[model samples]
Target: MCDAAETRPGIDPDRLSFTIALQTAADQIVNASNITGSDRGIAKAVLADPLPARRPRISARKVKCPMSRYGTTPHETRPLTSRSLTHLDITVLAAAEQPAVLPPSPANTDRRSRVFRLLAAADPGQDWTARQIADALEIGHLRSLSAQMGQWITQKFLVREGRGRYRLHPQWAKTPGDSLDSTTTIPA
Candidate 1:
């Protein structure tokens, strides 16, 4: 029931608005119906049947751990000073700290990278098989690697000495692409 005594006698808009709102909220709670479903449903859930949830006795700072975030045992790191170290361990650690120079593009994206790595690993004047290149690079698509050889063929980047074998063309590597121009990136 609206507080009629609280309502002003004449042309009282504010009390009427409050009366309407109180009735709307109570009506929604009884139906468990989301009238306008914004904050109303949450308020309905709370007020309709006010029940307490069982929460564990825990604090934020105490729960802040790497294992807690990942929920894994293996990832839990020990304090650095607690561990014992050897001379080789120190050397390996120092070497690991130095950043490795990665190849320019994404490692497994382009076939050119896999081909280059395979060629670099091969002996001075020896040719590498398409399967061998695929195996060496741990790449699944041997056909794509074979297709890359064809690209090298069209570009004249390497001499495809027939039947899937490619040898580095010394002349192509040495010659610059641009005519009398500087700041041009020549093909490697």
Candidate 2:
């Protein structure tokens, strides 16, 4: 049975089954009343000898990163440098002092503006749901959406395709200068 290990080239010396068997057999006689201390010491020495060929070596490499402060408010600590600095926190800004100017005709305004952009991007006669517009424009209030959307419908810039769906009036899509923003005009 033990000669099996002689055929295996990479046999483990610490195999639990073999080690436990050898330890159990040796513990009985090695610590027996008849065995002398010198005999026990010799047995222990033979069992404790390390059987491995050599120890493994280790290697390492260095890494570098920009020495910058993380988690510090950039405005408070770092100078603004990148093109990504264009995002302004408009939430805290004051409302405009003057009343917003309405478009020259009842046909153009914010609601119409948003609708025109959305409809212009859709298929020539494709219907779009109000829900789709709300999501696209990030509209939160239904009343505002209704009022805004109603302005476009009333102005004939957009037409209901049915089931609360709408499409840009074909003529409105073709018109080059039919802008919807109030008090805003393209230079050309």
Candidate 3:
């Protein structure tokens, strides 16, 4: 005869049927032998079907995230509430309170001011690339200074001379006395 425990793939038979069969077999073996105490308890517990391994009867808790339905977007971004903001502020303050090896210094301030002064002094007719400017000013970081030059161009303090070249705005470079039209009336 074919074994009763044999199972076909994709077809799950009744689990209780297998549990009853195991319990009956265990009971028969127990009655025929001198099984007692812990051994008998284990045999009974195994066949008792406490938390069956094959199909766990877990009732899963479902969570719902807030979503928008108006087609503005699938999900709307929720801003941090005041309580969460306070918690974030506290975390940031705690981190900031820790002793840091590198404290804020004004090291780059002088260098940047010097760079602006050099650019301001440059001839309006002339253009200087980042390397030429860096070499003239003895500044080592060409890339960073070039980025600063681009910012100056944006601010209208300098003009881009094309091909990564920069020149101070002609009007910016001119002194009050150097103006072509020196005739001016002062308002009293």
Candidate 4:
């Protein structure tokens, strides 16, 4: 029977054999002239009862290490939080609206500088998503740019406007020829 099933298209021999074995075992147990009447009754009850309906199994391929800077695990939807902007946030937003000159010389060559220059040169009140910045800078990997953006945020070179949106920090919105070092502070 299993050999015939194997020759047929879309039929698995192993599955057919297992089903036959299971049915034979069940028949033997239920029909056996066993010693215990209780065991027979239990087996009859189980056989008579319909099996519960089962959900179909689903399979998905998932990455072990997600490239996103936001979270370690993959998520279908991310929760958006709403909060009132603080004094500093408002100041940064207002300052970000002002146009600033790009840093000179070798500063334009590095990844960080290129990002800063793009954000700095953006039109008033314009913010950039990681993908947008990556596209603008011709960066191949948005994840790499996002990671660098996170670092820039920590270094006070950029301010996060909203989820995945970034703008130049108010502190760094200075005139031309100023040192681009993260440590240097301009007095308000």
lDDT of 3: 0.54
lDDT of 1: 0.52
lDDT of 2 by residue, 1-188 (tens): 13333334444333324554456457767667435443443234334443554343232211133453222322343333333455676667777799888758553445556566666765666788888888887878867776766676777767878868778777766355454354544121
- Per-residue lDDT tens digits for candidate 1, residues 24-70, read 66877798776565654433333433224334323222334666432
Residues 72-183 of candidate 3: C-alpha lDDT, one tens digit per residue:
2324353223222234333444445756588666433455455555665656577888898899888888889888888777777678979888877765675645532223
Ranking by TM-score: 4, 3, 2, 1
> How close is every model to the real structure, measured as TM-score?
0.33, 0.34, 0.36, 0.37
Worst 10 residues of 2 by lDDT: 56-65
Q: For residue 187, what is the lDDT in candidate 1?
A: 62
Clashing residue pairs for model 2: none
What is the lDDT for 13 in model 4? 32
Instruction: Report residue 62 deviation for candidate 4 (angstroms).
Output: 51
Clashing pairs in 3: none
The local distance difference test score of each candidate is: 0.52, 0.55, 0.54, 0.60
Model 4 — TM-score against the truth? 0.37
Q: Model 1 Cα displacement at 100 (Å)?
A: 28
Could you give the C-alpha RMSD of every candidate to the true structure, in order shown?
A: 20.7, 24.3, 19.9, 25.6
